[model samples]
Target: MAFQQGLSGLNSSSKALDVISNNVANASTVGFKNSGTVFADAYASSLTGAVSKIQIGIGSAVQAVRQAFTQGNVTTTSNPLDMAINGNGFFEIELQNGGYALSRNGQFDINKEGYIVTSLGDRLMGYQAIDPVSGDVYAPATASVDTFRPLIVPASGVGAIETSEISLNLNLSADAEVIPTPAPPAAAIDPSDPLTYTYSTGIPIFDSLGKEHTLSFYFVRRSDVVDTTTAPPTYSEWDAYTVVDNDTSTLTHNSTIGFDGVGRVAAVTPHVTAGVTPPTNGSVFSALLGTDAVNPNVSTLGLNAITQFGGESKPRELKQDGAPPGEISGLSISRNGIIQARYSNGDTKDVGIVNLTTVRNNNGLSPIGNNYWVETPESGGFARGTPGNGMNGVISAGQVEESNVDLTQELVQMIIQQRNYQANAQSIRTQDQILQTLVNLR
Candidate 1:
């Protein structure tokens, strides 16, 4: 009878309608994928191989409801924590149930525990800044792919680094008059007297305690040698002195810088001073610099780049390696999934690297609500990679992915399923009328 076929049609159509309704409802959901219902024809036949063309189908059955994993439209958001994928791959997140899942939704925030977490409290898994086995966050180590950890922001600020090395470039006026060396009963170079030095400038330095201090350089013309071999006499020879905080008593005869003495500075040789001097082209200063303030790094001064020219004396550049402690100011993410923490002291460092995972079959994933999916055997083995690597997609910071569901297509499908339901009902009614006619004839 037609009753069985009509009833089967009604059941399959109802299931398809439900699927269409769900797609329409979640059109605005972020990272939501749309699913479609697939129906297969059902038929009854004997094992002896009945006539293929003569056989008629009995009904339709729901075969599968597969979710599409196509890329969605990316839109910018105000939150820096929001992220979107441009091509393929999912973010790996850990659940409280002792298992892990993959997700496309990138809405995340830092919890009070300093872990990056989603709205459902699931922690985002990623590669740590330091190796997990080391247990030392300050030490930099290579990240391992075999181990994963929850991304976290350090509670303490970055520690201060004391200055150990300093480099300076300067030019001294060649026309400056030479200072006469004092004899017995006379005091040495006084910083306040103009006759004490030709040019003086101070460079800032950081102590072991992160406190700022000044290291001043005093250039005094010691002697001028006239090169008779040259077309005209050339003047060259200067003594460089170091004083901290303008204290002349804490002086260290740092270097004796001399030029080619041929009108222009052709070559310069800096003989850095120690208790003993190394072999060089010129005389080396042998003053004791082992005092409390200068003992740490007095021998490191090199004036190889210093010059004597007919111009105003001034420092060209000063560079030092040190930084004060900084507090966390903000966080930033790159397209390659590197998370950097910005500090108040103008320092930045990588805190974590987001993990991106992919499967052979996305349709085989089982959705467990909250925009998450779990790996199943049908999905095959998982391949983990970082964002913008291999086949993985690039991440867009401060953005979100819109739902892939097309509302217009879903609405049209809903109308077609509604018509199928009406047709099945009409077929049932026609079958009932035939039975009534047969009973009347009997």
Candidate 2:
């Protein structure tokens, strides 16, 4: 009986040592959780066989090996492939062979087929991204595949030079001084002539093929015929502005804009070019400016940051309802985990939202190797939602969650388990000695 109990004690201590060693070995693994070995004493019962509370010898057995749920520290890395979960959630991945797996490790990679799959080639699942124009999922309806590659927006598409709107600002200084008018039927004028004052600027415009066309705007202040009765303080409200594309001039007259006294531009007349008539109602104008203050449009125009769209599309009635031609200024992560993209055209838009998911029983998930777990009937159904929604926590970019194993704690437990194993071995030795003495006496 003593020998049997001693053997049982040895086996139990061995199992505890195994658990401790495993904990220590995986201390550096990402997302690893340490497990503890539990033990219980086994006893036997008999009916009325001198049953006077006789104490049974030590009979130990391992009861359970439970995982710890303590949180792990997060570290930042430069790799976009590395990911981390801030709180209660796991990333869903699918095997190429059609089975699904779950993991807390967010480290991922792209497959050879341009798919954004895990390092192990498992596909990451997500709500299929929808097309903005067609309102579809982009792929064919018959396709069942749901994973997708990280989308890389082209630097030249609607994002590159989206010409939604255009604005211009200018201050025409009227001196009220008398100037000579051009003679009748005179188209060509001398450059050095005092009668002509040229106002020119280069505006970057896109052609029909999306190629840049530097439209040089020349506003030659053509003098108006003044009556002898009017004094030097009188000035004409109409200012002639010509828009040219090199010597092959597109427009050689004033745009649809009109000016008032005190150098304030009131409205713009739609500009018309060869064989193309400007829309009657779709003309564009800037915010009205007073001489006391400098308008931002004028300031921005001077910096060459403002874009001028020169397309010939029949214009819809102009409004501030659409996006402007914006350049990629920069990007930022929002408080709600949405990516916001800013453009040079003074416009901002939502790019994408970060998502998260949680499970009712993480341990119950089937471990299919490669740090991946699969959903099973025992593991309750998945709860899918956005981050910061319900039990799901907010997202933190550029950070990764480390393994939960505590090295100091594991080392301490290792020492205790080692001592316990030695004691168990001594018990076995003592038991053998006692049996040897009994045999010697016999």
Candidate 3:
């Protein structure tokens, strides 16, 4: 009976040591969770199905092993795609067999197919941005469990949007002399000849096929100071002429600007061809392939910041909304787990929205290695959402979560389990010695 009790104690202690050793071994593993072993005392039942108060216990038996899901220490990494959860939730993964799994490992990379995947080629699941213009279209703030799919980056970069709006800001010289109307075909507004225009600047614009076209703006003083009744004159006027790619036929709108005596703008009329109505304000629309101002206003030239201060004409700022094609330059992840890709053309857009999952019983998940755990009966159902949505947590980019295992604590536990094993073995030995003395029959 003593041998049986001692043997059970040794078995339980050995199991505890095994768990401790595993914890120590995975102390440095990324996104790893440590587990603890449980033990239960064994007892013999009486024939009457009731335990006697004086009865001795049969020792201990291995009961259960529970994993701790407490937060792990975050470690900074150089990889831009690496992520860490600041609170709760797990990264959803799509396994090779079309099954889903959950993980905390944020070390991810883009595979040959442009899919965001782990080292083992399992795809990271998320709500993909299918339309470049309008990103993820989930009904809820976070995606539903069935709505999530594998995330893939556009390796070739997003398609180029034709230049639609040109925001122009500059000061026109107030002291410039008015240009006389071209008399008898006297070289009418030649862009190459600086004498034909007061001030001119050119900006690159993209076409329907991502073709680069130069759009030049020439400001010609239409009249000198008018309305002399007030101080410093009351009004001045100017005409703006546009040429796309040195061709006057591309756009046929000639707009005008009037400035008050204080060098402040009075009103501006956008350019428009004959039989075409203009827009109310500065808004550019694409005029690609037979598109007209009334139908496809390819680009809007903004002159809201234009003024007539008494100084040399100079540009304060100049930028266009269109870009000529682009390639992937970099990647970033937001607190809400929105992964974005940057392009060389200075365009940034969402590539995917990472999906997070939570179970009613986290401890019931079944570990299948690689920092992943599969759902089990006790884990219940998955409540899915993005970062900061519902019970999910926000993500931290360029960081990794270190294993929660405590090396010092595991080491101390190892020592205690070893002592218990030895003590149990000694108990069995003493029982054998007593049996031998009885056999000697003194």
Candidate 4:
């Protein structure tokens, strides 16, 4: 009986060593969790056998082997193909037969059909739920599970061009010389005009047909000073005009400037040149303001000097409603997982948000091929939502998570398992020797 018990002990220990070795072997495998084996002591029931002087202890038997799903360290790699889970979640995958699968391996590839697929050519699964209100799939109900696809650039899209936001950083020096203000003194030029200021704005605009056009804005300041104090001064108010023209049809805005009580230019009105018409070919295109007037309605008087002019010809200002060309320049990712694209036409629009998922029982997942796992009934269904939602992790761009294996820990476990194997072998040898002695005595 002692020999039998010792042999069982040796067998159980050997199983434990096998479990440890497997853990060590997969130490570098991505999303791999180390497993541990549990052992249970074996015993004979007294009711089943005749009573004995001493009830000898029995050896151990291998019980269960469980996996550990602790968090892994996230590392960055140049290839956007490499991905990692930041927090409590696994990427859900769809099997070839329509059964759902899950995995922590984020490495992905694009398929021939333009579908974002796993390297194994499995089409990524995304949610396409029906909308409650309309009783149909909501707008853009599908979401891609794989993230390693290249961003697609759209050739064109709907919606009219708008100049909602404009920022300017420019210089209007006092030493600026004028281009001999266009004919007839566009309102008798101000005599006090110390110097004339000139500036230009270049706008790359596009026609309604998507043809590229360049609209250059030129500003020639007649005079900055407006002496409304002179009781409707003899000269028309000194005004700033913006001329819009490309290589084609010349269009001019020579709108006159309105003055207040202090001879200061107040509001401005822009008008296209008498013979020329506003470009109907381009979409809401470019509008450039080169004059010192920072605000559309207000003009500087004291800090910036101008002459007080009164006459028939007034300076023409560019209409604020002109159309400009648009170009996609770059993209950005927000903390909330929203991705946005920037346009060269000085416009920004929202594109899409990132989705993330988590599981209730990660350890219960079944390990499938290609480093992926399939969800079993034991593992609760996915807790799906956007990134940073609930227990999900924050979304990071241009970064990925790395395998969590620690070489030092594996080496130590290796040593411990080896020692256990040796001890178990010695136990079997001793048991065998004892049995041999009994046989000799017989």
lDDT of each: 0.76, 0.53, 0.80, 0.51
TM-score winner between candidates 2 and 4: 4
C-alpha displacement of 277 in model 1, angstroms? 11
Per-residue C-alpha lDDT of model 3 across residues 1-442, encoded as one tens digit per residue = 7898999999999999999999998999999999999889999789998989988888999889999999999999999988998888999899998789999888899899878898889998887635447543222334665557888877566666776668888999998989876887565477778887899887887765566778778889878665666543549878787777787565443677777777876666655643344444342323433343223435666676788898799998888887767888998999998887788988887767888889999999999988899999999987777889877889999999999999999999999999999999999999999999999997
Give me the displacement of residue 431 in model 2, in angstroms. Answer: 1.6
If ranked by lDDT, best first, what sequence of candidates would result?
3, 1, 2, 4
Could you tell me how far off, in angstroms, the CA of residue 277 lies in candidate 3 after the best superposition? 4.6
Higher-scoring candidate on TM-score, 3 or 4 = 3
Residue-by-residue lDDT tens digits, candidate 4, 1-442? 6666767777876787777777667766666766777788877659867756777667778887777777776666564434566777666666667676667666655466544456776654433333356432211333455332222323333233333222222333333333456466363232224243244455443333333344454445454344546544422332343323443233444344444444343454445333333222111112433334221221111112222233322223323222445555655545444545566756665544444557788777887656677777888776766667678776555455555667687678768767766776787788888889999999
Q: Which has the better lDDT: candidate 1, or candidate 3? A: 3
- When 1 and 4 are scored with TM-score, the better candidate is 1
- Local lDDT at 397 for model 2: 59
Per-residue C-alpha lDDT of model 1 across residues 1-442, encoded as one tens digit per residue: 4788999999999999999988898888889999999999998786886757767788899999999999888889888888898898998899988888989888888899988898988999888755468442331244466446887877767766656556667788877888876895875577888777899987766554455667787788877874546543445767677777666676766666666664344333454445444333322333222344333533244455567777788888876665667788998899988888888867788877888889999998999998999999999777887888889999899999989998888989899999999999899899999999999999
Q: Candidate 3 local accuracy as lDDT?
A: 0.80
Model 4, CA-based lDDT: 0.51
Better of 1 and 3 by TM-score: 3
Model 2 agreement with the true structure over 29-142: per-residue lDDT tens digits: 776767888899876556755544775856799998777656678888775546677777776676888866677776655566534466777776543355668542222222
RMSD of 1: 5.0
Between which residue pairs do clashes occur in model 2? 256-268, 256-269, 257-268, 257-269
What TM-score does candidate 2 reach? Answer: 0.66
